[model samples]
Target: MSATPAYRRGMADKDFDFLHGRWRLRTRKLRDVMDPTCTDWIEFDSVSEIVPAFGGAGNVELTSLATEPPQEALTVRLYDAGEDLWRVWYLSTRAPGYMGPADEGRFADGRGTFVCEEELGGRLGLVRHQWTRLDTGRPRWEQAFSFDGGESWETNYVTEHEPLGE
Candidate 1:
């Protein structure tokens, strides 16, 4: 498919240890059909709790803020299944309006990428999020979108994770 190594899936557990904790996210604003240049940015504090289910696998629920409507209360969680190297699924309706359906993907070699595809008003679209571990002990999360097919992309958001209890 995407040239992912076979060994990658087997080592999911060993490589995901760095994700357990509290995180702060920073995302650059995205332009919409209404606004061409996104001059604002958003930030949030998130917490990830991992709990075991069965068969040596587990789940993670991440709670984050919704800056707009339902202000100070709306939140969304990203669900993860450990068996697939914590492949994530978006499971809440509280996120901002611009965000689309549940984007999903996995972690490998200290990197993670997830994407969501949507078709609205007769136009096809895609949203992708990626995470990469940096030498500073922080994982960087970035988001991009495409209108064509996977040929072009535009960065819409960015976040840096700092493990809790530091």
Candidate 2:
């Protein structure tokens, strides 16, 4: 049998190739997500593994956080060939049986940004996640929330990913 040719693939099929690997992440998060002036930030460690699926059109990510009680999260990313965008869904052990809101976006200029509507601290808000490749070829993820539409945003979490062996 002959193997499939890589060049024959479409743009939506390989957008997340950079995330396919094991990673160790250092996370810095604000203690209070709603309070922008809160300077109290907590640092933690986490690990993540991502693997391609759906014949390279999708991916699954498993992440574990080193919190006081220890938490685990999962994310599924699927690409829509027609729309040329990626849709993301997230879930966590902290809130069992409930999947978070869907976030949709595309990667551009080597960075990816996704946004969705969700409830944070009992208030409706817009949540955004950003992915960027660092100068060292590593990856970084940032999470922000906007309570008043998209006019203002407060960065709540930031994570830097380094390959497990590196």
Candidate 3:
């Protein structure tokens, strides 16, 4: 038997490394009534810090648009060595019950995609985030969802993230 290759040596130097530092996210709701028209593109800045407690998890925080207090709670993301993927979980005060679980897929071409498949309001919904880094030190985040078995997709949110000046 042969040993594992250097490139495929678990989650050491994979696409997960691109998630380090800070980012600006554009969140969209594709399946809701308020979505598809309103609140499509909201601007917010986010910072992702590596936590040693959870095996270098990506803990994120951003300002909330609906609230007046300023910022929201920390959304958690973990890099699983077993699956070689990033898993995200977060609790929303906007939604009364249930939780959000998102599975992330990163491409070698400097693009990333995340899909959230979980129950919301007793119904099945799938939300996805498409991200790409541009030449101007800015990244783009787009939100889309499929309700019918990946047959169709609806655009909900689209926002560009510009790097914060020091």
Per-residue lDDT tens digits for candidate 2, residues 20-108, read 88999899999887886899999999999999999889999999999888999999999876666789999999899999888998787
Q: How large an RMSD does model 1 have?
A: 5.2
- Candidate 2 Cα deviation (angstroms), residue 5: 21
Winner of 1 and 3 under TM-score: 3
lDDT, model 3, position 9: 60
TM-score of each: 0.63, 0.89, 0.64
**lDDT value for candidate 3?**
0.54
Reference-based TM-score, model 2: 0.89
Task: For each candidate in turn, give its C-alpha RMSD to the true structure in angstroms.
Answer: 5.2, 5.0, 4.7
What shift in Å separates residue 22 of candidate 3 from its native position after superposition?
A: 4.5
Model 3: per-residue Cα lDDT over 1-166, one tens digit each = 3444457565433444444445544443333433445543434444433223344434454334432334454556665555555666655556536465666654445667778775644668777777687344666767676777668877776666544433
Kindly list the per-residue Cα lDDT of model 1 for residues 81-113, writing each as its tens digit. 333534445544444354446666666555677
Residue 133 of model 1 has an lDDT of: 72
Residue 153 local lDDT, model 1: 79
